[model samples]
Target chain A: MSQFAPPVVKIEGITKVFGQGETAVHALRGVSLEIEQGEFVAIMGASGSGKTTLMNILGCLDIPTEGDYWIRNLNVADLDEEQLSVVRSQLIGFVFQSFNLIPRTSAAQNVELPLAYQGVSLSERRKRALAALESVGLGDRGRHEPQELSGGQQQRVAIARALVTNPAMVLADEPTGALDTQSTKEILELLHKINAMGSTVIVITHEEEVARAARRMIRLRDGQVVEDTKWVA
Target chain B: MGGLGLREVWRFAARGITANRMRSSLTVLGVLIGVSSVIVLTAVGNGSALAVKQGIEKLGTNSILVMSSGGAGRFSRSSNSNAKGLTIADAKALNDPATAPDVKMAAPILNASGTCTYGNLSSTPQNITGTWASYFEASNSPIDKGYYWSNDDVVAGRPVVIIGTTVATDLFGTDSPLNEVIRCKGQSVTVVGVMKSKGSTGGFQDADSIVIAPITFVQRSMSGYGSLSQIQVEATNASTTTAAMDEVTTIMSAQHKIKAGANADYRVLNQASILASSTTSSHTLTVLLAAIAAISLLVGGIGITNIMLVSVTERTREIGIRKAIGAPKSAILTQFLIEAMLLSLMGGISGVALGVGISHFTVLGVKPVVSLTSVLLAFIVSALVGLIFGGWPANRAASLRPIEALRYE
Candidate 1:
């Protein structure tokens, strides 16, 4: 991989230690990595592994204890909760494993979530929310709440929410973990389409099938990256 | 999106409230009861104050009366007892160039309670006051029939009297007592005039009363030969009346020859002055009640905080999803705040309705004039309670991290 390019994610000598004193656990130990913009990357690790921690750091959801992390030129490690929220709201859209839609909220409202944080006017928020849902082919079902939607439809709504802000990247953690095979395929295809749209996409999961869908893989064992590979799909 | 925040708050609170329907209702009920109580009690207090004010106004706020002080009007509240009784000397002093320049007029009153008779018809003892002609203007006493007797009656000691409405009813029915001869207190006095119905003035029926000959007749015949009882003095206007009072007090003291620190033998009193004192006391009581009512609103605010806390706990996943989709902590806080305000505003509205109802009933059972001030006070208080109480829990909701919230099962 070329190092001179504009990298979407850059980590230098990152170490994430959990707890304090002698009983502390080192979840990431001086790990360093870089991924360029528009790259579809996958992070894989078993239970107790720190792949999710690395994913969080790249997503600006967590700060590394003892290193520098840059996302689209902004330092993640130095950002406070407010700064992090700004980055999270405007730069990196997130889709969780369980299709974490707001319970009792309508699909359109869930999609409009990012715009609300952006201080969009009411009409603009509604218009953009509807457009985002329409892109996911769920326009007619905007009024349907989370529970009324299928697993696939719910994931689509989550994806719509992530895409609504036109973020620099989409950070998805186990995006298909709770879906059936059919819904899983649908979710993967949605991520694939979002990846093709020029935004960098990072998927964090332990599943091999999910990892294979990404263009590059960074595999972790325990707390260290053991394999970094690019697979032709 | 509406800054009203109520729409959003209600939308969200509906979820929390629905989860434990009975519990929420009970809590709302408690709050409602507290709110209504505040409104009701305040209305009652305000209503009573108004009645007292009206009664005082009827007695004339501008009139000054001098009554016999301690040890004089001792046995009878009606009699201007004590060594304090205003003498003809004070009445004469009212016109003195050295002292009472601002004194518009003064009525030297000699009050007598006695029966009046015409031929064979006898009436009960009525309130008979021997006063100057200026008594009509100062005390708002009106004449219904015949002209008042001239100053000749007082100067020459002519036997004549002015009769009140009650005396007219009891003695003459409706035949009119003007130009009639009546024996009063064992003296034959000709009726010269009849006083119009003054209705009730400070709980005393003034219409059914009579006025007799000057202080001389009342002292010698009516009150067992008592000295002059009281003097009513009127000032040109209510504004300069306080200064006029100072002048009167100084002159009277000079006449009575009392040193400083001695208990006054005579009491210079005014219904308007008494009313002002009563208003101060009533205002204190009102403020006290309003403070207690304000506390109930605080309790209502706390109730909102507690309920919102429970809501935050229950919807942990929702917060996670919102944050994941780029909803910031501020957004979350605003959402929760809106919900809280909405709940309280609704409760406030309900409470206002309840308050008005209670106030209305308060006046209905007994006449209480519920004014605009009381209603306005209740509204401002309730809304303030909502804002202050809802603030904390909403902030808490907004502070939750997306990751932590997501991790919540």
Candidate 2:
């Protein structure tokens, strides 16, 4: 692929350090990567390999200690807190391992939260939220709260929330970590369907089965990338 | 899309509050109690103050009274009595415009307690006021029937009397006391007129339980004495009462042959002075109660602060989620502040209703006059309390980093 196409996400020599002095912990040491538009990528690592820190920086939730991060050709590393939040809302959607849907809020309302923060009118927000819920095949459960849904269905609602704003990319952190094998397979399949429909997706997982679902896989160890491979399907 | 609109933030706050119904209601209740007490106490205070003022006004705004004081009246009946006290001559001097220019009318009052009887009914000690006919108009007491004893009656020491309504009822019942003869103080006197019912003055004195006659009749026929009790002076107008009192003091000093620096045997009490003293005491009481009410409001503010801090800590995850979804710090701060303000505003409204209801329905010791100013003050103070108290917690919530808040568990 030509670099001139401008990858959706680009990072070079990014480092994240926590604390200072003798007790300093280097979470990400000189990490570099590029993700093209509409790409389905998986980052695999054990708990101490700093994959979560990389995910945090990529989602714009935290800034790197050093190095440049570009998302959609905008310098993410240099952006202010307010600018970072806009980038997070307009460019990246997050799916956590715990689903993270507000407990008492209905699935549709949860999906509408990002749009509401974006200052969308009430009617437009409701319409978009319902449409996103329908796309996740939970059209009949629009008013159902997270507690009332099954694990796999809650994950679907979260994915709907993630896609409600039509973000440039969706970042999933252990998306199926808390699910049973059947639900996990269903969630992975849903992600695959989303990817097939031209949405870029990044999955962070320690499980090989989850990583295998993506065409491009990067393995991390000791806060550094050790293997980068792409399968020729 | 750049920032959250105030409308959106408000809706979000409403949703958040409703999601935890108990907590919101409890917080609202705190503010309600504070505001209601403030309004109610102020109403009661205002009502009592008005009542006192009206009572003092009923005593006649243009009247001044001169009475014996400093134990001078104690030796009035003794043979070796030296204190001149208040005398008929003093009243006569005060009535002279050249001597006391502001004095419009002066009446010599010789008060005596007498028993009145007619047919088979009798009254307990009825007060006998002996004065000129002008005393009726000066004291704001008007005769309802017949006529007051005239100057001719005073000159002749006539056996005629003007009885109050209560005394009239006691002596004659349904019968007309117009010309009926009533026995008083073992002397027979014809009822020449009936004074109108002057219910009560200064809250305690029964104005209608009296018999009015000529000062000469009181001194000669009733008391069998030659001493005067007090002098009641009426100024030309309400504004001239102090001037009238001063002129009366000067004339009385010369009449009694007293030096300028010496304390006169009698004290001149003006209506304005009495009104001012009463008003000041009532105002002080109102201020004390208002202070207590303000303290209650302060306690309410503390309650708001306590709950808001807890809410900030409890909603850490929610704050993190909002931050993640592009809610700016200003948005989060506004969201929480609007929530606090709404709670207090609603509380203030309900408190006003509650206060007005209580004031109208219940029988407070005072009349409970609900002024618009008091209600507005209570409302504004409640909102200020919300803002001042909610600021700290909202700031804490806004300053939280998304990663740290999200990881707060």
**Model 2 stretches with alpha carbons more than 4 Å out:** A5-7, A12-26, A65-79, A139-141, A180-183, A196-198, B1-11, B68-84, B97-102, B113-127, B143-147, B162-209, B222-227, B240-267, B361-364
DockQ metric, candidate 1: 0.37
Candidate 2 lDDT by residue in tens digits, B1-409: 3335665666667876786889888888888988998888888888888888887787689989887754433245463355576777888888898888899999888888878898789975457878887787778778899987789888898989999899988878878899999888888989999988876554667778998888888888766566577788899998887788889888888987879798667788987888899889989978887888888888888888888888888889888877876677777888888877887887888988888887784346677888899899999988888898988888899889998888987
Residue A81, model 1: Cα distance from true site in angstroms:
2.1
Question: Residues A1-233, candidate 1, lDDT per residue (tens digit)?
Answer: 35566688888988899999998999998888888878899999998789888877777766778989887788776677777778888888888788888777789877876776777766788899898898888999999999999988998998999999998888999888888998888888888888887778899998889998999999888788888898676
Candidate whose TM-score is highest? 2
Off by over 4 Å in 1: A1-4, A122-127, B1-43, B73-85, B92-101, B111-136, B142-217, B246-265, B363-374
lDDT of 1 by residue, B1-409 (tens): 3221343445666766677777666556555656776777677667667766776665556678776674343233444333455577877787575687666777788767666677788876556677676777777666788777767666766777777777878778878778888888677888888877666543455545565566556665666544466788887777767867877787788777767777666778776678888889778867787778777766776777777788788888788766665666766777776666666666767887887777766444444445576667666665666566767877777887776777888
Per-residue lDDT, model 2, residue A66, is: 96
Q: Against the hidden true structure, what lDDT does model 2 obtain?
A: 0.84
Each candidate: RMSD to true structure?
4.9, 3.8
Find the 10 residues in a row with the least total lDDT in model 2 chain B.
B71-80
